[model samples]
Target: MDNHTTIAAYNLAKSAYANYGVDTDKVLETLDNISISLHCWQADDVGDFETKSSSMGGGIQVTGNYPGKANTIEEMRADLEKVLSLLPGKHKLNLHTIYGEFNGEAVDRDQIEVKHFQGWIDWAKKNNVGIDFNASCFSHPYAEDGFTLSSKNPEIRSFWIEHVKRCREISNEIGKQLGTPCIHNTWIPDGSKDTCVDRLGHRTLLKEALDEIFEVEYDTNYMKDAVESKLFGIGSESMVVGSYDFYLGYAIKNNKLICLDNGHFHPTEQVGDKISSVIQYVDEVLLHMTRGVRWDSDHVVTVNDESLLIAQEVIRSGALDRTHVGLDFFDASINRIGAYVTGCRASRKAFLFALLEPTELIKAHEDKGENFERMFLLEQLKTLPWGAVWDFYCLQQQTALDNEVIALVNDYEQAELLERGEVLV
Candidate 1:
């Protein structure tokens, strides 16, 4: 394909994807609805915590947890395929690869005994693919310190190193088999303050672990080059990849990439530097969505926030070409599709808002010493009228506001967004 076709391929792909999640019947209804942009599916959740009662992003914590529904591996994969077919070719997948237990006990990461991985790869191998690595580093209880959680003992650190090496191999194998890249969705369950945060001791150890993992082959035979990294699995204090400006320069120098997570950037307190954190190292944004109500875990985000600001930062950064926005959403209950739709819609709106935001914020930040941090979406929304912003920029052309109430609810799309916006897509 020539330059135009290559770009067209991406746009054609994007159109299908932009209206993802809504089913054929629902899709037409969605064109009638307006929130067609927010369409996705629930693929994986990594927390080992399970329960007798089922809930979104919770039940999967239990083993043998399919609830007499779609429990079998084949059955589960078929469920995945069924959902994909429903969306047609419009939507790209935010596939959360599973490292889940059947009932309760942790499934060995090294054991590729089952066909779950193979089945999904077989299905998505050639399509315009998108995926997320929602695996817990805690599955191997030995990672108590972290992936390379500063083990003093050579044996312990060696074990962790070997674990990473094994995972790399599995990742390479899977990526090669499917003709898709392996996304490194790192969530440090064992990470916390003084745990995996900013302490030089921990960062040094984490760096060592990272160096070791990168050095080790992602596969037994290094046929497939795995290009990936965890979005934010470090200390929550220093969790936001955009905030670590000092370290990011080093990461970029080393050819590593940052994968931004939606949940990890939450509460504002977490994502300090936002875009700048990954500007040097970011290759993709791993969209991790959940309800915002904290359950002492990464729950679903019921509302939107400064994430819009960050999305604009991403847009202005001119890194969209390098970005593959993958959602890591999990609803252990409520028919899976709910988790998918909620995440899909929210992320789309947030990004659309950012793209639509006037470039003046960016130029202003660049001109005066004013910080990009000062630019917030909600504040910008106050300036623009709802109709002008929504109808022209965000909503599908000629579509009425009643068609997609979410668009109205998310004022970022039309009013404030378009007047000063520059979202090319």
Candidate 2:
């Protein structure tokens, strides 16, 4: 907990890892370069400040009645400021189209433009962080039927196409202003609750709509496009128009980045294994780190085996430069700030654990056909002084070490969030 104790422990850890040919300093440096994008919706439970919807009509759901949820753009930004301060290194923020500032004026999805989000861009500039954008194709009147780009009606499909095009333009502007290429991700809740005979028809329309939406050329240096797929949703239990195969093939053909949401696949599918296979063919990929309990529940992430494997696959495959990692889980059941800090820290810890592994040693054994020895070394590396190294990293960052972060969150809730009472527009 103290500086001397932490320094001594780190020294011991450095020596222990040296025996395995591992460099603790190099691991800390590498971890510092990795920026995990924090999702903005987590602070507000997906309820945008601009809308007054009694119910979020999207197939997705954020089930919890937690107090102190952000109800205004100012509140959301303030909460995020606290979150960023609590985190280590630099990071980016993921923003949805609905989270724009319109000065309390009504702005429809179809009518959104760069002006609506200039405040966010300016905020990012002041904070010295990058911004990512997503088009809100759900929770609107147009998406009530669980379809957007794939809608049979020409008017409905065309509206969404225009909206996505504007979002891309906004993303390009954000990246141009921030000097970092923004990843513009697209996701639509288009599917059927029951088995439909028109599955092929929907996919066909979706492809045509996407082709039209991506017709305008934007500089890849400013922004890149990514398509996200989901297995199914609450109402769309039977079929999802943009299935994994559909987007995977589309991404390969169009040279676009494919987003792999951890909660979007079947229970048994290892998203980690898919990473190596995807990067071999695609130029780059985006990852939405989430936890799926039986299905795509979007619970807060933990330092579990799934996360460890995912981090290992990325590190072992040497795909860090090509992968854009971001947090995507939202749980209104717990403290909003707590959820953000917990998920982001868990991800960093996973990466840290993977970085501490004696990977080269294991790989050398495998190359020599010593399979059992490789497995034994991997199992043994799990019990090393990785925790001490992590503590040292936290100490160096001047952040709360271990469970101390919980106390910080609780103090903020009591001193600030609870006294705020009702949120104003």
Candidate 3:
């Protein structure tokens, strides 16, 4: 905490007009002033494009692909080491599996992990590298559409449980040594209401799988069903966010952590209230920071996009109780550093902005028995189309772009591949 005021977030732009106002290196220095723990670029950090999209005034809608410029631990570690050199001290790092393999691209390929999670741990430990924690989800070939456990097929579910549990264990061990928990930000791509029951099945599937995963009692005497049930099971519920409140309720009922992904709430739930419910059930919640399209939940974090409604919920949750921040983003074709640096910097600012707001605003509205957060937004909604306002916001953000190195960032708000330069885009 050398520069408590400088502990804000930062991003890597690779010198492009879109990032004209921010210097990649300086952005690192700036983190010290804002007191940021990590940088994030969930949605559009992995791809490269030549033009901005008119759809959202940020990124275009491309074929299936997740963003964030990293493919392997070696690449990610190199990028991380370089970023750290720019800014120093007690910082955190996060890369996500959100929209991962965007269109099944990350399909559990051996290349994603040349070795295994344990292999990376050994490599890091042997090199004496200062290890950091990771937040992840599966995107295996079996996940052609979704992860195995997300499937109804019992065989697939069994296969997925082992992979998930094994990885989770390794992640936990790594995090424990580094003083962080391997946060699991789960969001079922099990799309919403294809018909009705189609998606509803996701609920039951998740419940049974989790309960079974965590069913075994450590003690032989505590085992359920005496002779029929497994003996050494631990509910996998801790790593999931229930498909439905009932399923989520099951997790909470079993004392499991209900991880929250902000992007998943988009086009659906109210940020503040929804987050409050999660807070009521789970003590530790991971903040999924990614942007999206109108109906499609894209994971990019363009500063101009998003209503900042979700951040408000997180702030309130943090103020009222406890919560954990998990910066989530992917680079479909953009620079890894840029995805993390810029996304994190902007998010930290948004969070700080909320923190600076008077408690009375929420309280005063609450005093009058009104949902001030909702009321304030409601008042704005009455007259504003949000489009015009958003345009104005974009114009304002344009000025925040840095020019010295701005000319170098990918022109199209695409994702990055610097971390995976040795592999493929």
Tell me the tens digit of each residue's lDDT in model 3 across 62-165.
33343334443444555565444333223454433221222334334212231234444454455333222322223334544343455777777776655444
Q: What lDDT would each prediction earn against the true structure?
A: 0.42, 0.90, 0.41
Per-residue alpha-carbon lDDT of candidate 2 for residues 206-274, written as tens digits (9 for 90 to 100):
999999989997998899999999999888899999999999999999999999999999999999989
The candidate that wins on TM-score is: 2
CA lDDT, candidate 3, residue 83: 44
TM-scores vs. true structure, each candidate: 0.57, 0.97, 0.57
- Tell me the tens digit of each residue's lDDT in model 1 across 173-212: 6666644566544333333424334455555665676576
Runs of candidate 1 exceeding 4 Å displacement: 1-70, 82-107, 110-116, 126-135, 144-149, 191-203, 216-250, 270-273, 280-291, 294-296, 301-303, 331-335, 358-425
Give the residue spans of candidate 3 off by over 4 A: 1-73, 84-90, 95-115, 118-139, 145-147, 186-202, 216-247, 266-268, 296-299, 302-307, 317-321, 331-336, 361-425
RMSD to the hidden true structure, all candidates: 12.5, 1.7, 12.5
Prediction 1 TM-score vs. true: 0.57
